[model samples]
Target: MIKMRNVTKYYPNHSEPALAEINVDVEKGEFIFLVGPSGSGKTTFIRLLLREILPTTGEIYVAGIDVLHLRPWKVPYLRRNIGCVFQDFKLLPNKTAEENVAFALEVLGRSQHVIREQVPEILKLVGLESQGHKFPSELSGGEQQRISIARALVNHPPILLADEPTGNLDPATSLELMALFDRINKMGTTVLVATHNREMVDSMRKRVIALENGRIVRDQVRGVYGYED
Candidate 1:
């Protein structure tokens, strides 16, 4: 669950705010899309969630932890409960797909035995079991993205944040990726995806929170993509 109340973000020396008065409440098992045009503060919203940037004003609580007041030492622990995916596949080029996912667990100090067992299961979950030995350059865009997803979810984080996840893919591949996210959501993970794909948004009929000019213009259950294209 995540909550943001009257949150505003202002960059230093900027005359205008990047995010203005954002207030959102997401339930534990909800799947929501954050849709908007470029520069609409979708990425800012996610950075706030990840604690990559702090809010200039207002409060943000993620999974009942006060993100605004979180200690620097505790930030890593907070992130352990959440997973994130981005448009660019951030995999290490030298590592194979399974190694990439397992690396996430290894960073958390998980045992090698545990890493070996869990990594394959997660790779399979993301439909990339056979691609485990492949390097990043060897896989297609979609496959590489799935590897990233596997890395993010291998920890079984209760929440997942994806920013422009399908941005670089073709329409058909984008749909397939969206279906993967849907399946992940159905397995009880809270999913928040920030994207600009109107067709996919309309077809999914999921909860949508639309932002424009740094403000939420619409919050609808089973919402269509309502903004002018």
Candidate 2:
């Protein structure tokens, strides 16, 4: 559902491109991992998908929509098809878990009745039904992250993009989260998780797209983590 061709991104004042000559096609319902060290363009690729930054060159298509040709007014519409999670759970501090997940549907102008019906289902899917009333500060790191995931997925988005999602958690919690992602993928949502967690990547043995210095070095099915210590 994602296609990139010779994609390159250069930030102002940077001597080199953040992403260089990227080309890949990720099909629907596929679960993929973006594995890279810091500054290797994993975040850049995510931003490109989200249209947070424009590519300096090349093209991108998500679900057959040409990202480069999208009108300014259509950006939000494009994002509606994508669910994103980041390393620092970007939940509103004051909002409860249910409210946070509901907020996503609300922003889409979904009716209150729809929000009421969908929010709890998403929370339950993410394993946060019991804590929906708790604020982010009141929850454990893993719980907070799960809430974030719930918010992202509440819209039943076709593609889920997670960046460094397990960064702040302990191994056990990270494993739990990864298992949750696996479940999400199994339900037919395309999943792309960008992370540097070698152990988790190795254990999962999913498709790995390894990046180094803004270039794809490896793309393997049931791939092991290949970066050296």
Please give the TM-score that candidate 2 achieves against the real structure. 0.98
Model 2, 1-229: lDDT tens per residue?
A: 9999999998999999889999999999999999988999999999999998899999999877899999999999899999999999999998888899989998889999999899889888888789999989999999999999999999989999999999999999999999999999999999999998888999999999999999999999999889896
lDDT of 1: 0.93
Taken over the whole model, the C-alpha lDDT of each candidate is: 0.93, 0.93
Q: lDDT per residue, candidate 1, 1-229, as tens digits?
A: 9999999999899888989999999999999999999999999999999999999999999988899889999999999989989999788999988889999999999999999899999889988888899899999999999999999999999999999999888899999999999999999999999999998899999999998889999999999888787
Off by over 4 Å in 2: none
